[model samples]
Target chain A: MEEIKEIMKSHTLGNPVRLGIMIYLFPRRRAPFSHIQKALDLTPGNLDSHIKVLEKHGFVRTYKVIADRPRTMVEITDYGMEETRKFLSHLKTVIDAIHF
Target chain B: MEEIKEIMKSHTLGNPVRLGIMIYLFPRRRAPFSHIQKALDLTPGNLDSHIKVLEKHGFVRTYKVIADRPRTMVEITDYGMEETRKFLSHLKTVIDAIHF
Candidate 1:
């Protein structure tokens, strides 16, 4: 329960949007901003704000990539990956502890 | 993500202590106040406050049971059981969606 409380209070993943962004980026490592916005069904402005929060927490980095056109990309930092992993593992522990 | 957000915003289980209380009572259905306090490592006053919130939400009912002595026992209502089950199921979905 203490662990769950701590996880819930996490600065980076406390909000649902940020948590969704992190979960989406955890496996892929990096993704285009547009792709994330589409996948999460968030507007550009909303995603940007949440991404800023994640960046401020050192959980993610955003930069522009030049391909056919200039596009924004969001990538999870190593620290972010580790923290997300720990959160998920602790959550699994809590879930498993419940017998029924 | 929406489901996760809804669960996080739940009035009864939003707080960690109340969530812990629900999880602890889900299986047992009913438990003594002292046992809950001991199990969750919460102060008597702290547990009382959380229990009051749960009761107000119609999640639990507290009453005195006179066995050897009068002891306050907390029991989960059917509504609480249903809501807790839904919360756990939604959480499981979110966890399963993460394929890292």
Candidate 2:
């Protein structure tokens, strides 16, 4: 939890688009690329880039469906789940501490 | 907390320097500029810029000491505290979700 908090301390989550993606994927065991794109209102390129970053950091896993049409599915791993919880908790702590 | 989470989702806080400043200020009622700098290993210029960003968001409060050696004091606001907590929580959530 401390590690996750440390990582998230530098950047505050302001991009609703990304938060939408994370929240959607966070609860689900797995989801397809198209599903995420539609839910996030993001272009293929934009979502692709976001997923790539998450993947690069080992926060998400991508499984390619090699059927008639290639489909990519994403899943949040344990590490990712921990990060999500930590992120949310930290925000709550900070909010609770707010002066106003 | 939700608002803070939304804001922090876009950028992951990876800058240790910024995190240090935040943690230091988070628990303290007020701290001087030099105190934060020495504790954070940040130069005046770097710390000043960081403080400016936090100040812009109303996360921190600054006061000048007119006794003698021209000192500046900063305190974290309630809003900032809430933001800090939210940020930490979200990161934890993300980490917990990771597979590995």
RMSD of each: 4.0, 5.9
Residue range A1-100, candidate 1, lDDT tens digits: 6665555456566555676788778989999999988877878998899899889889999899898999999999999998888877766677777765
Q: Which ranges of candidate 2 are over 4 A from the true structure? A: A1-20, A66-68, A96-100, B1-31, B35-46, B55-63, B74-100
lDDT, candidate 1, B1-100, per-residue tens: 5765565456566555677788889989999999999877878998999899999989999999999999999999999999888877776777877765
Error of 2 at B95 (Å): 14
- DockQ-derived CAPRI band for the predicted complex in model 1: acceptable
Tell me each candidate's i-RMS in Å.
3.9, 7.7
Native A-B contacts reproduced, model 2: 0.08
- Clashes per candidate, residues 3 or more apart or on different chains: 0, 70
CA lDDT, every prediction? 0.81, 0.66
- In the predicted model 1, the residue pairs found to clash are none
Most accurate candidate by DockQ = 1
